[model samples]
Target: MTDDDLIARLEQQERDLLFSRFDFADAWRLGSLLVEMATERGLPVAIDIRRGPQQLFHAALAGSTPDNDAWIERKARVVERFGNSSYLVGRRLAAGGRELDASLGVDPARFAAHGGAFPVRVEAAGVVGVVTVSGLPQAEDHALVVEAIERFR
Candidate 1:
């Protein structure tokens, strides 16, 4: 899809996906679901769920490495900072001929606008947490997280 098409779809995903209330239990359930889906698909992914700075769940499946963990942290930071899915932010930036990383003259170490992390938006509570996956292609990582969220709902 074109960058604009993808951006529009990602925005819709953000709007349509909402949690009534996301607690520790909810984190566990969603995290576990991501793991299960990844395992079934044989996707070597690293999954993480967090509330602000507090991490609630994390898993690094076989074949995943420290790099995947770093990607998770970076991508998660994008969602946490922008309150938008990392994929959407990346697509928007790319469309403008910029990037979330150093190519845009921005700090490259902490934030990654790649497609993997998603904000956890709760009803009336706003975006409170982040859910992320790494290892697959960025779009696949994004889709996997979205699938788990849908399954959890």
Candidate 2:
């Protein structure tokens, strides 16, 4: 087969794996577990764990602010619009200095709203989801999700 055929086959395989078996409950459970672990690790965090249109769980640890909720909402909207947490990274890499904004839909401003989201895939639960955190610095918010992924693993 040609290289195009190989690439198409691989892409199909990835899509099959990505959409296989997943939902809100799994996302919620993993998100809650992450929050619990982060608290145990002494990392103050705000978590919004979701799958599709449903929010399975959320927690704003002590010291996390109300504004964290807004950030989480914006981040969630961004991912929902763009279909991935890495949209912000993509927008940042775009040469025009454009960004993504939830308020502006999935346009060039997407980076502004999607700066703090991380995707999580749970094999056991058969779910692909996202864990969003805010209130902390953007890098820290991203780090918390990474830490959660590590702990979940």
Candidate 1 lDDT at 24 equals: 96
lDDT of 1 by residue, 1-153 (tens): 888888999999999999999999999999988988989988898999999899999999999999999999999988877889999998998899886766655576888889999999998999999999999999999999998888889
Each prediction's whole-model lDDT (CA): 0.91, 0.59
List the candidate 1 regions with Cα displacement exceeding 4 Å. Answer: 101-106
Query: Which pairs in model 2 have colliding backbones?
Result: 99-108, 99-109, 99-110, 99-111, 100-109, 100-110, 100-111, 101-109, 101-110
lDDT of 1 at 118: 95
Worst 10 residues of 2 by lDDT: 10-19
Q: How large an RMSD does model 2 have?
A: 7.4
In Å, residue 105's CA in model 1 sits off its true spot by 8.6
lDDT of candidate 1? 0.91
Tell me, by TM-score, which candidate is best. Answer: 1
User: In model 1, where is the ten-residue run with the lowest total lDDT?
Assistant: 99-108
Clashes of each: 0, 9
